[model samples]
Target: MGTLIFNLNMMKMMKYRLLFLYILGMTVAACNNDLPDELFVKRVVIAENGFQDLRLEYPEDGTVNTQITISISGTSVLSKDVEAQVKVCPDTLDDYNYERFVQDTMLYYTLLPEDCYTLENEGKVTIKKGDEYALLSVQFDLSRLDMFKDYVLPLEVSSVSDYEVGEPKYRKALFHLNILNNFSYVYTPSGAKVYNSGDNDDYTAWTTDLTLSTLNYNTCRMYAGGVYETDTDRDKYVIQVTVNSDSTLSYTAMTPEINLMAEGDASQNRISISESPDLLVQNKSVITTTLKMNYSYTYTSPEGYPYHRRFEGTFTNDRTVFRDKDGNIREEW
Candidate 1:
């Protein structure tokens, strides 16, 4: 009787263990069927390296209106239609917010005015079944904006239908636009051929060098150099040119150097503007200005006597085909 009772207890324990294992396998299979396998709006496609910055130019002579297309791509082909809503909203990471949150801030951008830009996609775009992308078109009126100001447009994904939003970083796109005035071109000189009757018989060949001291849409400050010899003798001059109300030009150069004279002993240097060139002319690349300068400088001769001289000449500087030191074309403003 004792042996029969022990056999019955052993059989009961084995049966309970098999029942527990069978239930666990069924529960795992049910969980696998409930996993998600749907599509989502991944990100906005930008032209360069995922950066959504756009630059538009406003010409001085003609009216310019720009149109740009914004594309949103999905993670996978949609089994059903998915609609995404886009809106012009205040940037979450604006200048004030960025300064409070970011640790190492370098630059800050101002928000663009809503009245200067318009959208034409009805505020919503749709990705149909079997499609993977949607587009939103925006237009900017360049004439309405101030040319000297900088602006930014912030766009956000407000909502979506039948799909989930993507990564937090890709949910919003920022567009940076800069408006520049008419006289923003950098005028670089190639070289100056000095006309003189003193050092090199009648005329001397000299190379001209220029550095931009101050630059803006309304004014340009430049320091010009003319080398008569290797390093023994040279002329240093500074000029500030401003755009007048009539779209003409006026300049102020206190120390205008006339490369002809060798030495002088005067304290004041005077500059007179003769004519202004039209910058909008397409074929006209060179500017010739006849300037009268009453310059004075002192130099010691071998006999220990100071020499003085005064002269005037026509200065012609061709728009130095803009190029970098590496011989590459520079980017336009």
Candidate 2:
């Protein structure tokens, strides 16, 4: 009986010791909660493509309030203060040329330590426990960007836990911007038409109709004999046609008041009739008339269709003083 009682007592003592050790381990873990493994960013929200703001939480879901807070404990793994910093750069260096073409510029964040917290360009930060954690705030401006295409901004963070002072480490973050296209349409030609509405797509030599010849992939040339407008709307037509050189001609076209960045650009060459007396003759005699002409034009728009311009003038034998249909000297004579 005595031996049995002694054995039972030993077994109870062992169980008690085991339970005590487990409770002690739990207490130590709770006190060392601010260890390196426990310390981390809880939320990383991107305000814009080029800006990433960090949110650190303690004890889970603890709001740092307009500040980035890191917890550190003196007893456990992260027993030392942390050091942190951030760095940033453009995502596509090769696309820099395109950015310049569009007048897009780059900007970087100038970080300042908020509430007396220290923040360095290297992105080093420090924090401690029982003291409202240190906060880091970052400010950036990107309003200068006119347009963006497949661009990225990268950020990195380096920090060291309390106990590990010498071994500094880092984490990375990123922001993005995708600016769309910016362009405008000033003027464009629809197609050409003449007295003969046949499919005049091919013409070795053309007259009267003033067919435009294809100059290049994007250009065409024409000398219209009859009356026509440079625009299909016919709101504006060639006022006076002066034979330029053998293959080219200089003519003035009337159009709606133009609003453009640069005046007198090719766009200003609308087709219109000048009320000047030299171009507006009356009672003209019909003689065997021949109009020798050549022209080449270009398409500023995507479509290669030649914009039409109306050419109106009476056939005349006397080249010195041309007569309008009214048999009077042309206006501006």
Candidate 3:
């Protein structure tokens, strides 16, 4: 009798399982096509809502022009014109950051200051009759931004004249602008090889990818020999370099700890950057920039041992520049 009751329970559960699957299939089919038009009707939205990562190369005029697109989403275009207003809604920043970071305010994103960017279209966008999209122009001033700080340009389609604005999630844009300088990049795109000598010893050699952080338009800072990025005494070995217009570079130790320094030839450490002719490799033409450095410096190690170190190698990078006729150019190489 128990065996028979168990079989009955199994059959009953199977019937309910099949019924649930049938209902789920019907709901999915309705969502796929049979749903009412009102549910999927067109709504005005900032096309680039969520986030956008922008790399700002050194602009020709110190200003980079960017655009935001606003559109009406639906199966067809609206018959009438629609106007949308965009705003730098920094007030909404706190809530956005809170959602992403919870209570960790230290890691929260920061708003890009007003002086750093100019909204050329004054937050106005118009999709004319028979059109579905419009653009708003914006320009970023490189000089006004801080290199070390993370900035997010928070924007929203605050109001719409015709169609209803998009859902809360689709109405805003968080643009993360990454600014670049002449000699530094967020990526480790350059290689370094260092040859050292200490305590009257022969030579110790090592190689690494050079991570240079920009300090100015033409200068950057890097760790000594491109090593020990997190070393407590790293400041003593940190070097500030200035890439000159003549393709030459000058270096200065951040701390007096690197007491003695000189160029490879025992002169004031000034080196030149070399570039190769555009070459076709893997079906792409690229210009390679090489920084050939030769220098010796004296600094104490973490164990309190003083040593003289020499580095002689080439740090290389290559980038293809894309420019327009309107004085817009990016030569990161």
lDDT of each: 0.49, 0.34, 0.71
Candidate 1 error regions (>4 Å): 1-51, 59-75, 93-97, 100-107, 179-187, 191-333
Clashing pairs in 1: 264-297
User: What's each prediction's TM-score?
Assistant: 0.42, 0.26, 0.69
What CA root-mean-square deviation does each model show from the true structure?
15.9, 26.0, 10.3
Candidate 3 weakest lDDT stretch, 10 residues: 266-275
Candidate ranking under TM-score, highest first, comes to: 3, 1, 2
Q: Write the per-residue lDDT of candidate 1 for residues 197-286, one digit (tens) a residue.
A: 244344434334333322344554543323222443332334455555543445555354423222222211222223233477432233
**For candidate 2, lDDT tens digit of each residue in 1-333?**
999999999999999999999999999998777456545432222122223433211111111223333333332343434454444433332243345444444343222213312224345555543342355553322222221123344544433433332222213334333211100001122232222222345322213334332222222233233334355633322222333223223443333221111113232332321222333434433222232222222212226444432212222122234566666655211
Error of 3 at 113 (Å): 1.6
Is candidate 2 or 3 superior in TM-score?
A: 3
Q: Judged by lDDT against the true structure, how good is candidate 2?
A: 0.34
TM for candidate 1 is 0.42
Model 3 misplacement above 4 A: 1-39, 91-108, 186-203, 232-238, 253-262, 265-283, 296-300, 303-308, 318-333
lDDT of 3 by residue, 1-333 (tens): 999999999999999999999999999998779655545667888888887876766654667788888888886647788888889988777787888899988788778998888886688889888787988888888767666577889899889887688997899878888666766742232334444564435555555567777666787778777357677777678787777666667778877667536465423334333434335532233445556666667867668887667765566666665444553444433
lDDT, residue 325, candidate 3: 52
